[model samples]
Target: MKYAVIRFPGSNCDWDMYYVLRDQLKVEPIFVDYRETNLPIDVVAVIVPGGFSYGDYLRSGAIARFAPIMEDIKKFAEAGNPVLGVCNGFQILTEAHLLPGGLRKNQHLEFICQQQDLFVQNNQTTFSNQFKPGEKVMMPVAHGDGNYYCDDVTLQQLRTHNQIVLTYSKNPNGSVADIAGIVNEQGNVMGMMPHPERASELVLGGTDGLRLFQSVVTRQLQK
Candidate 1:
């Protein structure tokens, strides 16, 4: 299936995501600029790649969410189509209210760049269906505001509903409950603070991230 990788001016990982989909996964990825509001009809998935949009001014994704395309992204996600947001993309999703809670500054208040181990918490979602829950995989994370936080009530609901998709095997950014990723209740839209595209190739040190993309593409074909 075709995917659209949204591109804001500051987006750095757009090409990485594109290369993974096109060269590695053999799927077409259309690079849609931030000003565009309509998605290609052939696009079965959307990707908001990692980047410091607007120089991460005001806050990460606070400015990026105002891009003309985000409203459409939200609508596309609400229609139960797959949308994967990585790093700053995760910040955008939270800013746009596409997902719950917020990503605060790392508890240590520093930008962290490191490879981390994450356990699949829920494999039922389109993003992680290829793996079994509790499986550990390595992915790279780079962000200053990767610490996920929410009120106790919302946290309880997320846990009770099994919405948490991935968790740090060992907390790295001080994220709440070691959450590395999560999906909306509908299970279509997924957001993670880690850069899966960066880990999709063995040359990049690991190929574990590829399973997330393959899971969604395979599931769509099954439908």
Candidate 2:
């Protein structure tokens, strides 16, 4: 299956995600420029990789949310196809209202970049099925706006629906409820502050993140 990697101006991690999916995961990677209005016909999954889009002008992803490609992504996601957004991509997903909640500046008001410990809160979802339930994994998080926040009612709804998929073992960004990643209510779309593409290879210090991509492949193969 083909995976579409959306590339906006200033997207540094787009190549990283492309490499992992194309080389390591053994899938076709189609780079979709932000200005494009359509995804490739064979694309089965969409990936919005992390980076400073539009130079992070108004807000992290505020401007990029209006990009033409996002409308196609929104429709793809609504069709129950898997969509994974990392860091700035996560911010974009929320800004576009594809995912609930929003990411704000880190509590300490500084950019953080490091290996982070994360617990898989739910492994049954499309993006995390390769992981064991409650598994602890390490992924790199690099961002200034990674603190996730939602109101009480939304938090409770996330809890009630098991939409919370990953949480920091030791909260680093002061995210509400220690949430590091979450899926949508339908569970096909996921957004996270961590950069799984950076951690997907052993040469990159760990292979924990490879399973996330593998999970998506496995899910597709089963269908």
Candidate 3:
């Protein structure tokens, strides 16, 4: 399956995601510039990889949300095309209004980088289809504004809609209810702080993240 990896000026993980797709998964990722308003129609999935977009100036992903490519990205996601955003990419999705809630500074006010565990909260979505509900997987996380927050009513709505995708097994970032990742209402868009691409290879770390990407490609082939 064809995957698109978007690159903004300060996006550092674009190449890492590309390598994971091309070298590890043997799928060539389409490199998309942040300014490109058009997207490749044939691409099956789009991934907004991590890094400090716009140098995380005002807020993480605050400025990058307005990048030209985001228009098409939003369109594709709205049409139910699978979209995954990691780290600052997650922040971007929230800022772009593609996903619910928002990210804020860690309660402790520090950047965190460590291997973390995430509970598979919603396995029905294409992004987490391979994992069993309640299962936990190890993935690395690096970020400052990883704290997720939403009001009580919205949190209830999210739970009712099964929008919570992954939850921190250990409450690493003080995210509300330990929410580490979430999916859109349609289950087409997902945003998470952990770096799944970083865990796709056993040599690099582990293969827990392989299934997330593989599931998208596999579903596209079935279609």
Winning model by TM-score: 2
For candidate 1, what is the lDDT? 0.91
**Clash totals for all models, in order?**
0, 0, 0
RMSD for each of the candidates:
0.8, 0.6, 1.0
Instruction: Name the candidate, 2 or 3, with the larger TM-score value.
Output: 2
Point to the candidate with the largest lDDT.
2
Give the higher-TM-score candidate: 1 or 2. 2
TM-score of each: 0.98, 0.99, 0.97
**Which digits, one per residue and each the tens of the lDDT, describe model 1 over residues 187-207?**
898899988898898899998
Runs with alpha carbons beyond 4 Å of true place in candidate 3: none
Error of 2 at 13 (Å): 0.2
Candidate 2 — worst ten consecutive residues by lDDT sum?
Answer: 194-203
Error of 3 at 117 (Å): 1.2
